[model samples]
Target: MKRTLSLILLTIALGACSTQKPANDPALVGTWKGLRTQTDKCQFLSWTTHLKPDGRFTITFFRDVQQTQAIQTEQGTWSAVNGKNELRTDGVRMPDVYTYQLVDADTVRYVSVAAGPSGDCQEDYAFTERRLR
Candidate 1:
């Protein structure tokens, strides 16, 4: 009876481990673009991001003026953390971490929280439209 109880307990433990969430696929390996929306001002911002296979990424922010002119652009690199669910950008003026969720094979959504010059700023969660080569 003792041996049987031990076997059942071990089996249950192993089963629980097997039910763990699978690791995210490394298919997040390309460039993506999206319309950035500012939560505070309710304005639309343009942005682009490139995810490399070497666990590195680059992002660019653009501003559209009068629906025709490109007014500004900011570029930076990204490093992945927390099993690729979080990323930190290099040289970003804001001190915050961006959390990501894979939407599909080619798309992802990222949310960023930071302290703006005036107060706390949180970006509306935005979907990244994947760019396929």
Candidate 2:
């Protein structure tokens, strides 16, 4: 009886360890905005990203640092993969991967992995996003 119980417990533990969490992170389901300072050519820019629980994401870009002028908006799907955030835009050929860390319950900082510009800019950027809702 003791051996049987130990074997069953081991199997259960192994099964638990094998299960993985869902790809989408619930904490990211909200509106977030950030600003970036660029070169003279690009100037100040702002990005507003809205992530939904259903894996849908929308990003709006502004030409100014204060997010006053809307420039473009892109729709995409987002997921958490291998401890990183992956965003697949609708019309883009490649997905954008970002390494992120939650600063607090209402803030997250992300750094784009050499995947090129995440917006209309010419290079990758690291920025912080604050939850709007």
Candidate 3:
């Protein structure tokens, strides 16, 4: 009886260690599009972001709200940290943190907390993005 109990405990411990943790913010693992207006100028910037389940992301930026002209594209990785989202792009030194919340079933809001190397126009910026269906 003593040997059987020890074996059972060991098996249970090993099984627990082998279990995988859930992915970070699984609901944000899709394509999202939004338009952010510049605070100091009459500029409307349109962006489309694709967040993968593998913690990778790609964002394409356009100058107009209609997204007819492509400006640039950036690749990065993102993760959820302390109820906020942290995005780290390639060639950037620091990560950009944002407060993310769900606006509706298909829409989400992201407010910038800290600016990074992504060429943000100003501070105190917020944008609403809809998940591409």
Number of the top lDDT candidate: 3
lDDT for model 2 comes to 0.82
lDDT of 2 by residue, 1-133 (tens): 9999999999999999889557687777899988887776567878899998889999998988777889999898898755499888997768888889888989998888746245445356678999996
lDDT of 1 at 104: 74
Backbone clash pairs for candidate 3 read none
Q: List the candidates ranked by TM-score, beginning with the highest.
A: 3, 2, 1
- Of 1 and 3, the candidate ahead on TM-score is 3
Those runs of model 2 whose alpha carbons end farther than 4 Å from true positions after fitting are 1-21, 40-42, 116-124
- Better candidate by TM-score, 2 or 3: 3
Off by over 4 Å in 3: 1-22
Show the lowest summed lDDT stretch of 10 residues, model 1. Answer: 113-122
Clashing pairs in 2: none
TM, every model: 0.52, 0.73, 0.78
- The sequence of per-residue lDDT tens digits that candidate 3 reaches over residues 1-133 is 9999999999999999888544678778899999987665547789999989899999999998888899999998898744589889988998888899987768988888888865666477778899998
lDDT of 2 at 68: 82
Q: What do the candidate models score in CA lDDT, each in turn?
A: 0.57, 0.82, 0.85
